[model samples]
Target: MILPAPIPDRVDVVIFGGGVAGLWTRWRLEHAGYSTLLLESSSLGHGQTIASQGILHRGTKYAFGKDVSQASMELLMAQEVWSRAIKGVDGPDLRRVTVLSPTTVMWTSESFLSRFTGAVAAGVLKSDVKKLEGDARPAAFKSAPKAVNVWEIDEKVVDSSTLVRELARVVRGPMASLAPDAHTHWDLPGMLSWTDAAGRSHATHASAAVLCAGVGNESLITSLAGTTSVPGAAASHVSQRRPLHMVMMRGAPCDLFGHCIRELSDKPRLTVTSARDADSFVWYLGGSLAEDGVSRDESTQIDAAKLAVHECLPWVDVSRASWATLRVDRAEGRTATGKRPDTPIVSHIAAAGHTLAVWPTKLALAPAAAGRVFDLLETAGIRPTGVIDAGEPALSPAPLPWNEGGVRWR
Candidate 1:
């Protein structure tokens, strides 16, 4: 844990979230010689980041439809940016972050539509995937029936918790944690006030204040928008939440990271990622299962997930597995049709001062979010001021979902 330090009264930027996007933006700002202070109401990545399946999507999954959509192309660019960063080029050096899988497998069921979608996706993403058959197949599919088709796609899975810690470590500034009951009051141009553990209130000022809190951004944006005098500032950007009922299974049959593709949908049927849970491993399930499962209660979702696992991977035995469910919201900038935004969005509130609302949309596009903030800062003529000596790190990374206690698995 980072020892407490006296919160600086001023800095270059005051970021309001400690998730991937917030922490990443902090790292970028500090590296560019700007002083930053990050404030989190809870442990880092508590809701969205840690719950993410950590798939660095390459837009291949988006090609299962009739044609590649704009979201697919945006993710393709994000994939390239992240891949380069992972290799210690172009962006932040993520070599120290743990990679759960270098590549992910995409498998098609015996259904004709599933096979057809898989074939079309292969053609569209030819350079990113390669077919595997017989002895070339990974052990996870060794027992697969002849009708099943599997291909390895170039996508990297990461330990989101580790990435959060790494980003915090490199930020080289103070990160403050607000008391659970503490409320933040924002002022023009970068002033933030909050109560501390001892009931002491502290306030800091910066050149810019960025709202990076995921769902929390909703209320914060509402508050800021309510006070802004700029025309259409309230409507300039809005936040939306797309809820997901993700399933988790402990004591999974095997370590597998892949997506099960089916017909009539552009999204993967089931996207599974493996992560260590103590001495054993757990499989975090997402994609269509999570999306469609949103309406399902806990028990119903678990039952549906069990059926999905059995149906998708008939070769694997999961009699001893226990299951649980996590309900999370995919927070992003609201689009015209309530669809996912194609890229990171940064909105300048300019409410009496430089206040901005930011949403990376996807975890892989965090760097792009930072880039957007940078462009805004540059365009506004905000230069790097002297760094604030925050003494020691002040915040800690949040626990992963599987590691968090009190989960009642069945």
Candidate 2:
């Protein structure tokens, strides 16, 4: 049975945010004997964690112009780390986690560009991609036209909700809720205090603090540092937003976990993953469709999804499918060109006191982010203190994004 935990007067570390990055960091630090407290403004996975398509990318999508860039190598390393964790060999044991698909398929139309992409992928990721013959293809593609080509790639898909639940089960911190507009203060010597909505002021002393709150990190850093930007003699903190409009379809004809490749594009034309509700199969779409959908209205986006699906999968009947759209922003360290960062971003602001701000560019890179945090703490000479057993109750877990009830269907 679970027990209540009271606020401790002190801790070795204080974490802000309950998402994957925050939870993973807590797990790692606590394992080393550090006392920790996690403060959450809302339910866990309420943001990008739940909004994601749950794809464990394998760098196939980032390959461009016959070369594998730093982004591609980072994804390959992430895959290795995640594979060990999922297999319970190293890191957290995720053996019980739900894996929606063990592998994903990549298919393309019969065209010059399409053939070129297949060749580049084959040369770059030779062992990772396998071409199938007539009878070896999946049933969904049996009805496809003669000109279509299909290849299987080594990428896995997981149930985001299930993954979050498993991570929460292993977290060691006493998770607590923070009021929407709670007032928080930080002092020079590592003292932190906050005023809850009930007008009760709680204070805690920590050796250090970390922020894994994604976009919310901006305001929190500004408020605590008393400046719009965190400026240090060594480094400065800045963030950028990349938004996506994702489409979801219920009652799909079949369960498909794959990507549709097009000629002359570095990204997939359509990326699809399937999950089951009580009675029907649901399809989640990402990739180029989601990135481009950001500029279109809801109705127009849904119509566009229908056309894309029909064009890509001629055998599927989408006329009876019900559609919905979800918009989410990806937070990352700002780049000179304002493009997405290839690797996770972790920044330390000595000028702002004992604080570290982190952004895991992709869900697959959570392990890498945690490793960076660990390195930062070690570099600062911060050691784990004894664990604290505060008697306060645990914070409630965040509901799945789909459960929030704001999904608009047309």
Candidate 3:
């Protein structure tokens, strides 16, 4: 058996949630000498982080047209930040983490509109895109028609599970699992209080409290502030959920990561990633197919995915493949148009320095979210007191997405 660690009476900062945003913020704060504690109601990376496709996007997805939006710029910055982290030369040492692919491939069937899109993308991406000649293409595309056009991009894919573990290891103090009744209160100046699972009351005079609970943020804030809306915003802070139904196939024909492009659509027809499962390989499908699969029943979705694979990748032999579906939601700050936000969102109760809430719009933007949180803490006059020792209350890590298995394979 296992035992819970003794809770500390006080700390400089109390962070709620243990997803990428929370973990990255805690790591940054701790390294900056803050006495910090991370509280999670469940395991780390229990939601968005683990469900991510692990793509270190470089704004290439937004390069479909001539004008790049603000979201594209954020992605560009995120790409550079993640590149440094993965290399371990600048930011956190992510060199020890598992990288599924150092680069991703983009390809399309030869057509006038498709060629135009590729040209526009190439012009926008510039040096980020490298055209692949006849023999330079991946072997998986060997069966592809001769009219296919392919290019390589500087995007990378990392194992999200390993990424979270690495961040958790860098934290100074142990993370704790919050009790169901662990109500947080911060209306009073310079005070934070909550109850533990054993019905024990605990209060801390923390400099700041950060909520990085993603979809759980709304309820958490409402419980503490008596409202879900943050003060001084155009409107109440609301969250939107974008759902995805991803398809997975075991016994993949080969290892591959690439996007299948078509003439009319800006988004890819399919995005595929390969991962090792025991001795065999598994192919995970996402992008447009996953988005559309949300409305489809399991059998219909699997059939659609299989048809997509057959059409886009003639080389993939799925005759003996076992299929599964994983449905998840992408939570983010609500927009006026109810579309996805282009950047991370950080908001606090107006003039109330004691608490703040954050949503990393994309997994690639976690570092950027940390920077914003640091800024908020600074604006609130919150500063790191000192380093906390490693031996404090410890929380168990979140299980890997596949290990937790909500997937129903057919």
The C-alpha lDDT values of all candidates are 0.82, 0.78, 0.78
Evaluate model 2: give its TM-score: 0.92
Q: Number of clashes in every candidate structure?
A: 0, 9, 0
Which residue pairs collide, candidate 1?
A: none
Model 2: residues >4 Å from true position, as ranges?
A: 1-4, 65-67, 134-136, 196-199, 227-237, 389-393
lDDT of 1 by residue, 359-392 (tens): 8988988888888898888788778886666665
Model 3, span 90-148: residue lDDT tens = 77778878999988888875567776777767676777889887778886777777667
Model 2 weakest lDDT span, ten residues long: 227-236
Tell how far residue 7 is off in model 3, in angstroms.
2.0
In terms of TM-score, which candidate is stronger, 1 or 3? 1
Order of models, best lDDT first? 1, 2, 3
| Candidate 1 residue spans exceeding 4 A from truth | 66-69, 226-237, 389-392
TM-score for each model? 0.94, 0.92, 0.91
Query: Which candidate wins on TM-score?
Result: 1
Least accurate 10 contiguous residues by lDDT in model 1: 228-237
The RMSD of every model to the true structure, in order and in angstroms, is: 2.1, 2.7, 2.8
